[model samples]
Target: MPYRISRLGLVEIRSLDLDRDLDYYLNVLGLQLTAREGKTAYLKGWDERHAYSFALTESDRAGMVRMAFRTVDPEDLDYYEKRLKDFGIKYDIIPEDYRRGRALRFTAPSGHTVELYNEMDYTGNVLPTVNPGPWPEGLRGIAPPRLDHTLVTAPEPGKAIEFFQTVLEFRLSEMLVAPDGTIIAAWLWQRPAPHDLAIVPGKPGGFHHAAFVVDSADALFRAADILAMHKARIDYGPGRHGITRGTTIYFFDPSGNRLETFGGYTAYQMDPDSRAIRWTQDQIGPAVFYYSQELNETFLSVYT
Candidate 1:
């Protein structure tokens, strides 16, 4: 059987300071703010069914525990539910909401909560918000039409990889492991946009930075300059990663969750059943370091 994932729908991150965080994502990042409720807000970078790439929920603690992707339609949701049942996996369905739109939630084998939503409630008068000023000139913006991927950390890395492959129908495109087999990392995707999600073994239930693709290397540098100019701390490299073949830079938004911008990544197109490929240590560096020089020790210490 074939399974298709259309797009990353909405990422929910818990936040306590909604005003400051939302300002950074909307005004600075240039995502168009669409709608607002009491503590929840929606913003989007490109034209889509809904208002945003990420939805912020106010809380004392902040972190992402749920990720939603879009299935083709109601029938597609049924097909996915059936696929989960075939493997004896458990899930929950969320009907339409004034808040989340429409979606179903299930736990991936690695016990990551995943949701699939179809419709984004629309209002007739949707327009791109005022240009939040020029996005640091020469800086490539997340050029991909939409938000593409998120990297998640799982304490039980091996089981997580199995769950994504068996229950969610994601195929592994590449794998990186330490020589001792203690820390394992694998990249998996449903479509050709490189890995939509990557599994890294670490603190369970924690999210690594979500990645957005840039239009050009110039955008990447401009983004770096803008970030530095704004005094936003840089967390990781402007260096290239051999494994993903992308130039990556990491920083925390005013919100504190790590965010990454990349210029290039290898795209994978293969049957879900294709054999998984592995990368040696030399190919991918010692580890996927989250904190780079642009980010200072103080910021790095907080996440650790």
Candidate 2:
């Protein structure tokens, strides 16, 4: 098998006020505005090579609209489509030039809308492919290099994990389980990073947070400063996650959707039968936050 799923392509997010959120994404979060249509504004990280890596759509609610995974092979789309059909998983095969190139949209077992695509317009990063400098001129705000990962709330994380394991071929990097053998949370990786997606137990269809990748722990600290300068509510840390060992800071946009700035993690490529780091429920404090040894009530209860 090839690299079936390479990376997450785009995150379509809902905003109560698209203009406000769009400004926050571009000015504070440092994404380039790729396009705009109606109430939706498309954006991309500086290092991404796609027409758009993010979409902010105006809606009454603040949450995820859809998240797409870019596949390594076009045939993987057809292969997964057939797998979905045979498994009785309803899906819609969207043709090219429509949304984000050719894609298949399906509701996962956890009720989150997910898309898989193998094609995208090659919009080069800020630097040229050959003999380019490290960064662009006058980068704005936090200026994270790329979108890293997303953590969503899944009421039945085990089922979602199982589907990702057997069907999508994702490997579990870490999981926190109850004594009854229930998955409280799971981190799943495809390739090139520790986790492309994380599932925490919550109501079906809920969204938790989407994270962006910076260059270093210093960048995360600078991000915290930028958040404070912008008067954005700092939800948590200028600290680290024990799970991924990434320096992170969580904050809220104007619309109250949580976002994170992160870096300083050792990326892992997981093999079949690779040992997963398991944390029992009692030690979940250290599992999530190493220094605090505690979790805020909102960390467990808040979702959109």
Candidate 3:
């Protein structure tokens, strides 16, 4: 049975120091701190049940490594778990840490850990506290409807991509491979909103970035202006990506985790049989009026 995932619920990451990184997400990036327990912190972009985003203990080894999503129903979760057992896939049931209400944890085929929560723990909707436009030059928040997707570093992109398709029922909206058919990068989508997850070549078990879908092009620029003031240097963006057809801006957090604010993504809700895609160096380069430099050393090293 194919798992019917409704939408991305929240991302749970292990941070070395909760206060230091959580400070950037709350005070700098403008995510509302909905709740906190010991070393764990739950954050919110907009109001929902509990928190849709959070960070837990583990600041010493900094990297985004976990994500959580909402299932269409409890039956879907059971269907997925049973299918994993039938196919010989192993998973775990992690209890709600201070933030997650009731969640089950497991590792994806690519070796990335993910959590599935049936509901958000809180009662009220936690919306963005910062008014994006009113802020000075560098400090701004990404005004998105909710959490978008995540980029993960996978040792075997093929295995990872396959797991999402075979196990999670994610469709491949776009794929890029080398001459030998080694999957370099993949963009998968569950609904019309661009990609729900991205696969990049890396050592298994770490996150690349988590993206937020902004409402408009104006929000993209406003986000950049605010980030610039806060000294959150731009990794790339304020332009269109050839794959998702979305205008995006990439930057790093105080902890060096990547984050993107995007708009104008082509909806894939219509065509179920979309073709695969590959991009050339020129396609993703500065010639398209986008800039790049030695400054992108970190992003390029992991992605390219």
Candidate 4:
């Protein structure tokens, strides 16, 4: 069967300091605050049409609450329900909340809370549909175009990869393997981007980073400048990746949640016969950070 899961729609992350994090998201990352219900704040990129794509909820600790993907059609939820049942996975039917429609919420093998939904109220982009300018005026910080992809951690990445490939029909784009044939990390995609979701071996429920896409390579450099100006903790990048060939800059939010501004990656289409690119553990250094040819300690160890 063809892939029914379309793309990543929303990511809800927890914040120990909601106000500070909210300010970073608005003034630094350049996301528009769309709404606030109690302790939760909803936000979206200027170019996004959904009511919101990223959400921040107040909590004592920092981590990901859940990540959601949108299906190709409303009925696709039914197809997934059957698949989940057949795989003996349990799930809940979440009623419409805020601007989002009802959804199927489940816990994956990696212990991450995943949600699949089909509808979100469209709020349109920042510009008019017809005769729109190149970009909106009064943009702040490193205003990215949209939320791109996310990387989360699992103790056994292979099992999480299996769940995505088998249950959601996400195809593998790239993977890192050990000499003994253990899968160290895997990048899987439903959309044309290199990876809509990636998994690496770490503590269960760990969120590595959520990436946002900029316009070009120059934009990525500008993003680094903006991040430096704000004195945000820069984790890595303003460099290239050997895996996806993308330019990236990794930084931390106020609550220690890592986030990335990424761009210029090769797009991978949904072709069944397409072979996944592989990197052995020996080349792990260059595979992850092509320019540095090494991994930073915090890149792997520090995650929310």
Model 1, position 200, has a per-residue lDDT of 75
Question: lDDT by residue for model 1 over 242-278, one digit each (tens)?
Answer: 5456677777877678777865533335565666666
Scored by lDDT, the top model is 4
Worst 10 residues of 4 by lDDT: 264-273
Distance (Å) between predicted and true CA of 269, model 4? 5.7
What 10-residue stretch in candidate 2 is worst by lDDT?
264-273
- Taken over the whole model, the C-alpha lDDT of each candidate is 0.66, 0.83, 0.66, 0.89
Best by TM-score: 4
Superpose all Cα atoms of candidate 2 onto the true structure and report the RMSD in Å to 1 decimal: 1.6
**On a 0 to 100 scale, what is the lDDT of residue 209 in model 3?**
76
- Candidate 1, 107: how far from true, in Å? 2.9
Q: TM-score for all predictions?
A: 0.81, 0.95, 0.82, 0.97
Off by over 4 Å in 3: 1-3, 47-50, 56-58, 99-102, 122-140, 264-275, 278-296, 302-304
Clashes of 2: 0
Q: Residue 116: error of model 4 in Å? A: 0.1
Instruction: List the pairs of residues colliding in candidate 4.
Output: none
Q: Against the hidden true structure, what lDDT does model 2 obtain?
A: 0.83
Candidate 2 stretches with Cα past 4 Å from truth are: 97-99, 265-273
